[model samples]
Target: MPHFRIETNVPKSKIPQDFVSKAIPVLAKALGKPEQYCVVSLIAEVPMNFGGSTDPCAIGNLMSIGALGVEQNKKHAKVLFELVERELGVPQDRMYITFQDEPTGNVGFKGTTFHSLFG
Candidate 1:
């Protein structure tokens, strides 16, 4: 599973209604994961600031069982940052995204952990 969570200072009204729809496919393609197993969430109107400014900045994280690493994350960042910019009007420079390589055992799905299912 790949879950992309974005916390932004942008108001809820400013976010596009089709934001999640647009993000899932893009994120799935970037992570090379099936869209069915990918999740995307946006928390708008968050109290956040970046570099002493609060002008539509965001903090995001991508947590997944695989498809994340030094070189891979760079590419994911480009795609995801573009998505956030287009959907939330948050500039690429103002957003920070963290990549996480999750252990299968650490993630639960369908009433069981990935580790148990895959192992």
Candidate 2:
């Protein structure tokens, strides 16, 4: 499972209608995961201050069972940042993204943990 969640100061109306749609494929391709298992969410119009400015900025979190590390995350950051900037007008310099490698045992799906299913 891979989840990409972004919270931005950009207003909802300013967010493109195809933002999530565009992000899904990008995230899936970057993580080498199936599009069906990828989740992308955007919370727009958030009250956020970055570097003491209320300008267009975002905080992103990416959680996945695998496919996350220094090199991989660097690639993901590049692709995802481009998508955000193109769709939400949030510059890459104004955003920060954090990555997390989730434990399969801690994530459940279809009434059972992924560890139980995969292990």
Candidate 3:
């Protein structure tokens, strides 16, 4: 399963439906998984100020799906940033993306683990 947690200074009500629709397919294609496997959670951060020494103009996490190498992750980040900018009006310069892969047996579902569901 691919889980996405998106945090933004933008209002939750302002988020575009098209953005969510397009994101699932695009992310699924990039991850080589079915769209049905994608799980997304959008969190709105009001009164948030983004900017720092390490990551200036940082808005929020772009991609929090699975672990990939730096180069590959950056590539995905670029896609995510562009989408957010175009769809949500968030600037590319004001975002950061991170990915972490859950261990094989870590994530679970209703009454069983993700692996159990598939296996």
Candidate 4:
């Protein structure tokens, strides 16, 4: 599972209508995952601040099972920054993206942890 979430101070009305739809493919390719297994969520028009200012900024988190590393994260961050800039006009410098590598034992699906399925 590669779950990506966006929390931004930008107004939803200012965002492109097809932004979310366009993001699916970008996210999948960024993570080297199939689109069907990826999840993208947006929490827009929310209060956010960075460097003690309420400028147009975003804090994003991507949680996933494997497929995360320094180089991969750098690449993902680049695409994410472009996306945020396109949708919210938030500069890359004003945005932050965090990648969390969740182990299978810690991620559960159905009635059991993903670790159990492979074991």
Candidate 5:
């Protein structure tokens, strides 16, 4: 249930055209989740400013039911930031990533919450 989303100030045309397919496995590995269950969404050309300046920057949001912790989060951030930089040419120093552990009951799919199936 790891849904990795990125909001970047870079234009969509500047990013690698095949980023979604390239990012799926990356996110899956970062979350230790199955590739089929991982979803990645990218929003480019966002009007965002990091460090009070307008430069190539991004903010990533990783949401999952579990598999997020201090060490895992740091590792994920490094991997995610690298992917962003490599794919979009966004500097890693200008990126900020936020991790969220969603409750099983709060996440739903196919008309059923994960809480019902696993919790």
Candidate 6:
């Protein structure tokens, strides 16, 4: 089975349960894998300024979600953007998301080893 990893840049204080509930299923569906087979890891970063004019409030609320090597990372990127926009009330342009592919062995799941270890 293909492995998947999700690295999110949200506030450390933010509840992981919130992200996990939404993210796990999205990754599983996007990667065409069973939800139970997927692994998710999150890395929270302190909020940072985006520079230039936009919305200070929005900039302060910036977050990034990175999904590593699913079947359709790019497509999932779009989905993630939309999801953040709707969930967090941040504009699509204000949020950032990305996906990358790694060597098969570089990622793992569960006790068997996959992209990440969520459970």
Query: For residues 20-51, what per-residue lDDT tens digits would candidate 4 score against the true structure?
Result: 77888989998888998788888898888889
Task: Work out the TM-score per prediction.
Answer: 0.96, 0.97, 0.77, 0.90, 0.95, 0.55
Among all candidates shown, the one with the greatest lDDT: 2
TM-score of 5: 0.95
Cα lDDT tens digits, model 1, 1-119, are 99999999999999989898889999999988999999999888999989999888999999999899999999999999988888889999998899999999999999999999986
lDDT tens digits, residues 49-101, model 6? 44453441132111122234455555766666666556444566655554444
What's the alpha carbon RMSD for model 5? 1.0
Comparing 2 and 3 by lDDT, which wins?
A: 2
- The segments of candidate 2 whose C-alpha lies over 4 angstroms from its true place after superposition are none
Cα error, residue 43 of model 5, in Å, equals 0.6
The order of the candidates by TM-score, greatest first, is 2, 1, 5, 4, 3, 6
- Model 1, position 11: C-alpha lDDT score: 95
Taking the candidates one at a time, how many backbone clashes does each contain?
Answer: 0, 0, 1, 0, 0, 6
Stretches of candidate 3 off by over 4 Å are: 52-67
Candidate 3 residue-wise lDDT, 55-118, digit = tens? 2233444333354567777777777777777776677877766677675467777788766776
Compute the lDDT of residue 14 as modeled in candidate 6. Answer: 49
Clashing residue pairs in candidate 3 (N, C-alpha, C atoms within 3 angstroms): 67-101
Per-residue error for 93 in candidate 1, Å, reads 1.2
CA-lDDT, candidates in order: 0.93, 0.93, 0.66, 0.87, 0.91, 0.49
RMSD of each: 0.8, 0.8, 3.7, 1.5, 1.0, 6.9
lDDT of 5: 0.91
**Candidate 6 regions with alpha-carbon error over 4 angstroms:** 1-17, 40-45, 53-71, 108-119
- Model 5 ranges with Cα > 4 A deviation: none
